[model samples]
Target: MNKWPVFCLALSAFLVPTAGAAGQDVQAGQILYDKWCAGCHGFDGAGDGYAADYMLPRPRDFTLGIYQIRTTSNGSLPTDEDLVHVIDKGMPGTAMPGWEAKFSSSQINDVAAYIKTFSPFFEREGAPDPLEFGRQPRREGIAEGREFFEQIECFKCHGDAGRGDGPSAPTLQDDLDFPIRAADLTENWNFNGGGSVEDIYRRLRTGMDGSPMPSFSDLIDAQFMTEEQLWHVAQYVHSLSPEEGPTISDVIVARRFEGDLPASPNDSLWNQAEAFYIPMVGQIIADERWFAPSVDGLWVSAAHNDEQLALLIVWHDPSESPDPKWLEWQQSVAASMFPLLDSVGVTPLPDRLTVQFPTSIPTGRDRPYFLMGDARNPVYLWQWSSQGDVVPEATATGLGNVQPRRGESRTLASSAVWHQGEWRLQFGRSLATPDSEAELQFATGELIPIAFYAWDGSNGEQGSQRAVSSWYGIHLEQPTPPSVYLSPVIAMALTVGLGLLVVWRAQRREEG
Candidate 1:
């Protein structure tokens, strides 16, 4: 697991020199912006272009100028270099594309100045000095940084391991009081602040606006540490990037809750349950991993009440669908106009996730293979499709016996929400399904064999091309109060003690 420094919301404000962008031509920038940016950002920069509505994170409404990412404090505007950097590299995991290849450095600098024109905030900017980054990264600095990380309690929100599953993760909120998740330090690609060492340092120094990541500048009063210590901590954070897959246990039992159950994927209550990440490697059947996957693994947690069972599955994706549905028409037009593009792939992707279980709980230790199952054994597959709004259950006797479920069943329902670059899918079903052989049932304590398959529509994964997993047992783990089992043990002990006493008396009497 990667260790992420707490999200930093840095000091109140700072000044930065225009430096390289000074005296750039705004008119030239406007022309470039119109050619490259107006299609999505709108001519007025209000983020209301024809393409903006279809964008996952709608194009930035520059008029508001409330940038989510910045080196400046919460309310301050980003520096010119900040804007130029974003344009040059492009924001990864978003619809934005880098202009560095298409435009010269001078053109990019001019466009950077033009982007500021949409918002008057930059006009009032007073010159501020760029933040001072002390010494270069060194091994000696890392040790000192570790001390600062612990001293400031960065472990509380980012977790001791920096996996972002800290004790306070579920309850973390932004300045707007909206529930916000801490950054999963391992997935460097999704870092909105950028992932370079300098980027990490800037994120730590400036902090993310509205997030729990507070800047340590003020916190680091000389008594606490020096400026170099802050840089060392940033380097330390960079080093903590997740090197391997998360720890996955062979057996995972569901935590049980009483009365009401969590309905949404983001519910804070779900955090109480034991989280086991089922990585693609752990779950994917060896013979079948045909294509390279866009994702490495998935996050999973399960909970059960008296009647309902909920499974929350989370995985990362760059696009919600295989490609933007909104752009399909345009893509077709371009393809038709250009015959040379005949070989260009236009995928028909159906994003979906499937869960498989033995049609009936397996007997003894024998269980079916994790795939669709063999002809000798059958499995029930409950499928959730991104295209379909409903949760339909299917039963497959083997790889070819895929059939729709018939008749009313005990339970099946699901809900999902997509946020940031991750999709949180929640599925619910009943503990028992009419006590029938055709349905898969769950008992309070007994283990049930379960397997998962996920399809990334955007990646053109379909049929067997999808990611698969080995079988993992799922069981409801009801909480046991200390005395529930303790009293029985105590009684048994006393009963054994009395019997021993009687035996000893008889032996003694006989000897006498």
Candidate 2:
């Protein structure tokens, strides 16, 4: 008789308290849920609240007894602790907000108990035991893990480089028949469950319920792979993301270089320049507000010589828009976000990026409106679209007011590449343009205001429906003076001379 099953049963009993537990009051939970959750989850817990239509992934229908985040086995009820954890920390990459600061532990517990009452399955089956997760073994390198990754066909949804642009990525839908996107493995910070290796291991073992992610526990049971081998896969997945999320900065400094700027985005010279991470949010202050935006943020690197300036912008995008493969994805996103509108004639628009600057540099803290500009103060723009290699120069006084500048003033040159779910673009221009009034002149030692707007056309973004960033600054770094480098050598020489003089003086005094 194996004692492991008995041990697990014993542990499960201790992990979850009974429904009739002392701290859990269903009536008290109802009051809290009605006050806090009713707006999105509905009074009947059917996920049809007023705000439900406006959100993607929608709200959880508690009556269905299905959850995406869980510690238990797939197709089983999430443990009470799982519910409490979600309620306290909330789900990332969704509309859910953490309630740890707002609700007491007991209050959260009461709500969790109350949520179970919506489904009859909970009453009949009770809470399920969490899966046994063994200790992680010593890493055997990502090579073996990469092999396992391919064997399991993770690339079918997560892509070869884990940017979520795989062949099946555009077609994925949740169990509820709502369009869904696969996780971008390179951005673990946005993982709904958590980003740690242990969290990844658990997700692999138990799988995410109410989603296409399925458990691999059967592989272990069938002796195809051992528990230790699965941990390697988790470690490999964990290695895909950065050690920490990118930090936001107020300014991007352009490094001074000796020669011409990097010829293309792939130039190794660009690596010498530090990359700045800029976060973006949907344009919501004006009409036709965008609630969901595909492009979340971008990485920027800048460099300049005496005559010219260059910028390399890198961002993750699942698809190169206008690609026939993503046509269905474009339609699905449009229909889901705007069900009342007709999407029959809709065609995929090209992806675009715009670099924004005030037509005239701001003299003070005051600047034009972030959404393009106001009539009184127009803004200059370097607009790059996927449809063409040319980067057109434009000016805008407001959201809809844009004038493209043609002929001699259009000196902006650009190169772009989309590979493995990422876009790398390099834009080059002269430091000083012929038409200073209509264009931005890059100068050293000055803080030039900068902003960005991105359009992921596959997500139905166009016109005012795009991702935008608040005003930031770019400073062209001044060249290092030769005197500053010589100062260190001068100090060392003086120190040695002073020590020699002191030794001589001491020897002369001893001789006397």
Candidate 3:
């Protein structure tokens, strides 16, 4: 054998250490649980409290043990480190406060051990304790997963790979130009707290709420993979981080811009869309659905993009300041949508984006469907009623200020740009066509009128002042990926292989 080959193999083995940590004792854990944790998390770890019912997203029910801040794979308990991180940094946007100052490291460890006692799954059976994440030390699977993120076209929304600077991120904001960026995994401190192995695992499994992160448990069938795999992926994503910049960058600077609109703009459709579009409807509709205050006339002043969102819709919420509780809950639910999609390798943008609005709330027993669209001009509003009846006329509402269109995709504005280190984006009429504007406009001039609208980041905080280069629609029917065709085959093969391996090991044990 070549000595060089042998040395290379040995070197690689040295670089990647196998998980060898032992499990902690649950007996000692019970004491800590009783002393410190049982108050918020009941004796049985069921999330119940006088305050629990009022909390928007509710508290973590440890007995159920479905931790949302985990890095473990689907259907696995969080590791010790996961618990420690949560204890250190309190969860944000919630009642969970960082406890690093309140508890000692040893106390935190005891709590983690105690938390594991609540669920049979956390008993570990024979799994690792500290539960290492990633394959190689220092930085595990960072480069590979980074490539995967881009290979799967995650950059289209999550921008700049791990940095969360995707092209479409700006348009995903709500009434406010809140730029939702991709999760910076390297930052062990999360808004929901917890940086330990299990915490990360839970996040990977359940996903963050009110954001676009989705859950992946369904694809994994909840138990397809070993807990170790989940840990590895979490560690891998976590490792893909950018080097730290000055702490000053942590300060979020507010940007506001102003722009002018054209004369024959699509104000009518815009008004109707607003009048009917529910950003946060009741449970009967979507949780984040909301109805616009009025359809009169308003103009887009600015736009922005922060992290992973691409469709920022920052219209004035004169109708009502969104229920803060509802908004918080929505963020947690929404955060999980994209992550879940990522886990299953689903492309963020599906084939076609569809805009659906109710023509009328529903009359007697008839539900009216409205087909809204943009007129021939990139800036004009158009609509069509879909009750299988007569179409309506082009209505004009002098409330919008979209730039005139000559045909083709209209370029919007860009608010902030991060290059090397400098963060800058123009705040004026820079809307011009960029790549990816194929078949952009829609035409339906006569109906109840509910058109879909999204803002490009070129403008800043308000709607864009620049003439839009073009507008894109949301994917109405996301198709199953071709890999879906191979799901049965893959599942069967893995199942059979695992069964055989188990049988072989059992037989060997018996012979011994």
Give the alpha carbon lDDT tens digit for every residue of 439-463 in model 3: 1221111111123332211211112
Q: Write the per-residue lDDT of candidate 2 for residues 46-151, one digit (tens) a residue.
A: 9877778767778999999998788888899988899999999888778787899999999999898888888898879977788899888875557777788899
TM-score, predicted candidate 2 vs. hidden true structure = 0.88
For candidate 1, write residues 332-434 as lDDT tens digits: 3223323355543365465688888888877554667556877778888888887883347888866546877756643788777765356788888887877
The lDDT of each candidate is 0.66, 0.83, 0.36
- Worst window of 10 by summed lDDT in candidate 2: 494-503
CA displacement after TM-score superposition, residue 38 of candidate 2 (Å): 2.1
State each model's C-alpha RMSD to the native. 21.4, 14.8, 24.8
- How high is the lDDT of residue 252 in model 2? 76
Task: Report residue 287 deviation for candidate 1 (angstroms).
Answer: 9.2
Task: Provide the TM-score for each candidate, comma-separated.
Answer: 0.48, 0.88, 0.32
Runs of candidate 2 with Cα error greater than 4 angstroms are 1-22, 389-391, 481-512
Clash count list over all predictions: 16, 0, 97
The local distance difference test score of model 3 is: 0.36
Top-scoring candidate (lDDT): 2
Q: Candidate 3, TM-score vs. the true structure?
A: 0.32
- Ordered by TM-score, highest first, the candidates read 2, 1, 3
